[model samples]
Target: MKNSIFNTILVTLSVSLLLLLGGCAKTIVPPTDTSAMATGSDLEYPESHNTGTMGEAGFSEDNLPLEGSLDDNSHSFNDTDIMNMPEAFRREHGRSSEGFLPVYFEFDQFRLSPEMMVVIEQNAAYMQSNPAINLILEGNCDERGTAEYNLALAERRAINVKRYLTNTGIPENHIRTISYGEERPLFLGHDEKAYKYNRRVDFIAE
Candidate 1:
């Protein structure tokens, strides 16, 4: 009778020990979707999915040049000079250069906003009226992301503007596109106020 009682106690103790161990154990579940595991820091522009020309060119930040400026100042008329021209001369050549405003974009976005579309429409109308005037769309980006990535993003921004202009009756050949990336900034600062100005596509006479 004593042995049976001792055996029951021992069995109870063993079961109790197993329960304690099971309570202490943790069950690890592996992530089912690897893409969902990406954190904000993993991507430079977390909101933007398009990598643009970087993928096509097979370029990385390490491979790109550190110091260089892209400029083609071969245009005959500057904004000030064009604006100061006589009314008759402008009518014969083109409208006031002030009409060609810089087109701005949202953070890390290449898609045109409704407001930006209106700006593009005005620029396109001017271009359509003055077929002799060739224009350059200078794509720029804020001081964010890798040089290669920014260049690619900027190129996409300019290409989108050009696409809109062409769709609005502006000849493709009359428009040249260039990407300055973060090399040329309208405002120099890390804040959104400055970044908003830097992220733009300027219209320049070519």
Candidate 2:
């Protein structure tokens, strides 16, 4: 009876020790990936994010309360419609109604005369000051040559003026060329005085 009692006590002690060791093992082992169980309160990147699918964070011009609306063009400007704009608005946008002085050429010649070069220089100075000015170089010729030949000459006249302006620091794109040839004469008479006035390039501001 004493031996059986001692054996039973030993068996009881072994079972209690095994149970305590199993509990300690569970408490000591840590999770492999802590991020997997994160609640995302202090996480660098959230497990799931809503990227403004229903306007939660996305930005759109249509949805924003902008100071100006697309239909409100009172503050906007169109370069092509500049001529129709009011004088005040035109001045505000760096435009002027002042005309550029015309540059005359010799009869049937597209080359710039020394005097004509002086005129072009002055024009370039004006253009430099008002860099926003758009120019239309209208080339005219005396009623001397055939329509085709005069038209070609007129184009050369306009191109020459354009080249001179561009060389003087004016942007080439700001100047446009149009050839009237001998069709639109400044002086209708068939005299040397009339021909002299007709052979010219007139600058129109837009």
Candidate 3:
């Protein structure tokens, strides 16, 4: 009877120990989806995804219109206003030489404006009235651009003016074109006002 009770007690303690060991054993947590964990890194670091140029990847400030550009309304008046006036009035205005007007261009553009066309019309009429008169169209530019670029731009300005004058009946042989680039500035100051004055094509009777 004593042996039977000891064996039963040993068996109950062995069962309890087995249950405690099982309870203490660490629960096996299956490996998580590591792909999902890595998805957040791309959002956290932006430069990692950089392919190359700003234009290729996304928007850039260079693509936007510059603030306070010359195109703003404040600079509405063009050089033609002062240049294309009558000889008597121009002398009073004290801006241009006798019987001719200077033509001006916007920053970085070779295209002639409506005001420029009007000035050219008056110039054409003057040349028509005086058949012996020959004119030299001197192209110029502002101080902002590179020397080579400005030279090319000035050439375009002069050529365009010459073309228009020829189209208006001034003989092509009568007009000569020259580019001074930024070397000859009509206005000496460095502001936009000065730049506006500098970017011009002056007409000198040769």
Top-scoring candidate (TM-score)? 1
Between candidates 1 and 2, the one scoring higher on lDDT is 1
TM-score of model number 2: 0.53
- What are the RMSD figures for all models against the true structure? 15.6, 33.3, 26.2
Q: What is the TM-score of each candidate against the true structure?
A: 0.57, 0.53, 0.55
Residue 7, model 1: lDDT of 100
Kindly report which residue stretches of model 3 are placed more than 4 angstroms away from their true locations once superposed: 1-96
Candidate 1 local lDDT, 1-206, one digit each (tens): 99999999999999999999999987542112222111222132233543322332423222333221375553435646665766445433332245487787776666676677788898888777778888878788887666766776677778778877887889888887778888866555798877877778878775
In model 1, the clashing pairs are none
**Global local distance difference test of model 3:** 0.61
Local error of candidate 2 at residue 122 (angstroms): 0.4
Q: Point out where model 1 deviates above 4 Å.
A: 1-97
Enumerate residue pairs that collide in model 2. none
Give lDDT tens digits, candidate 3, residues 10-101. 99999999999999987532222222111112232233432111222112222222122122222112456755655455322223346877
Reference-based lDDT, each prediction: 0.65, 0.59, 0.61
